[model samples]
Target: MAQQGPTAPVPVPKAGSTPPVSKPVREGIDLVVNDKLYRHTGDKTMPLLWYLRDELRLTGAKYGCDQGDCGFCTVLVEGKAVASCTTKMEKLAGKRVTTVEGLADGQGKLHPVQQAWIDEDATMCGYCQPGQLMAAVDLLSRQKNPSDADIDKIGNLCRCGSYGRIRKAIKRAAATMKDAKA
Candidate 1:
């Protein structure tokens, strides 16, 4: 009897058949995302918002509108506030990116801004509090005494119409920060 050869596996297309296009290999880069070292395996175009929320599990920055119109995804890059939803992870190389998680002290005590929000009962639904607190931290870091107009210009919004309380919280935080400095 003749020796039988092994049969080759058949390649079959599904109901809708389309040839796969060959995509170029993406250049991998090391990112110190949210103060922790990480090697991102995705394309350079991957936004920092998804990386923080999805990959690193840092969910403080909410994804409200994928577009930059909403400030829910705000985060600190090199101590300056930037929207993480549109910020690319590749741009954060060697820079200290601070999220709401980094706002607290090593003992896990809430930052003054965070405590002020609690004290003033600022957060309603609390979806936007992280971004609000981050923006407030940036504002107070630059100007210890930010005017009402300055607070308004920072672009912190609350859908629950907690604007009054938010303003009060910011003011209280500023006072608290000033007293601490004194």
Candidate 2:
């Protein structure tokens, strides 16, 4: 049997030589979603929409119009609607993020806005409805009696041309919420 020679000593780079490349350090963030605390660790520069959809599996926030023109990725950050497609994770630390999934009560009860959306049948292809509903919820919270211009200011484009239905739904939701408060 041939004798195997001792393995040559592994080459070690001198102290001044280039150090081995290390993996990029991951960052951690604390996010409150649907009144729940969630810890996330990953690239801080990633889009919030991607983080919500890919990591947390909250797929309600769509990825349409990643350029920020369309409101397909709309989400409520601390009760204000923001486009998640361009929102970086670093900007959302310790912030409350509300997607379509978070709009309802914890008991799986539909929010008045969601109920009105269903009643009004505001969805067409339904691709943009999540963002539309998110934006509507934020808007109604501030403006219980929103004007046509106010509805237009939501800036959520419906390629399926459900704008009329969306406006009606917002009005219906406002009425329902107002009635509930009374």
Candidate 3:
């Protein structure tokens, strides 16, 4: 062993002994998705999209640009629209996550936004519709009467270029939701 300097390294903790205090210990994580609790024990850095699609089978959040540029994996994390592709699972521990599948009522009644989509036939390929619906749901929750600028802020890109129909559906859904509320 080398000679110990005046400023030596801290000794390792003995067996069963607690180590020096530092940052919190990393451990298992619990995530709430669509009112369901999921326990994660592997790498905490896994992106939420993989967990939702691969593990939970909630595949509505499509796999698009995985770098957060594409909104195909958009979902609501605590009522805020988030890009699930780049959202780390560690950050979602104990957070409420709502996907497109969870937007409907427990009685199987579709949300007004979903109904609007069907009525307007806004889906073409239907791949990006899930993300669009999620974004629109979040938007409508915040603004009952969303303007064109509000729609633009959703940032969800539809490859089918169905922006016109989507805009119309949003308006229709807003009206229906308002009527239901009253």
Question: Residue-wise lDDT of candidate 1 within 18-88, one digit each (tens)?
Answer: 43538763355555444454556565787888877776778999998888767899999888888999998
Residue pairs that clash (backbone atoms under 3 angstroms), model 2: none
**Ten-residue stretch with the least lDDT total in model 2:** 3-12
Candidate lDDT values, in order: 0.80, 0.85, 0.84
Instruction: State the lDDT of candidate 2 residue by residue for 22-121, as single tens digits.
Output: 8763456767776666656667898989888877788999988798879999999999999999999899887888899988888889999899999999
Segments in model 3 whose C-alpha atoms lie over 4 Å from true places: 1-26
Relative to the true structure, candidate 1 reaches a TM of 0.81
Order the candidates by lDDT, highest first.
2, 3, 1
TM-score of each model, in listed order: 0.81, 0.83, 0.83
For 44-75, candidate 3 gives per-residue lDDT tens digits of 89898988877777889999888988799999
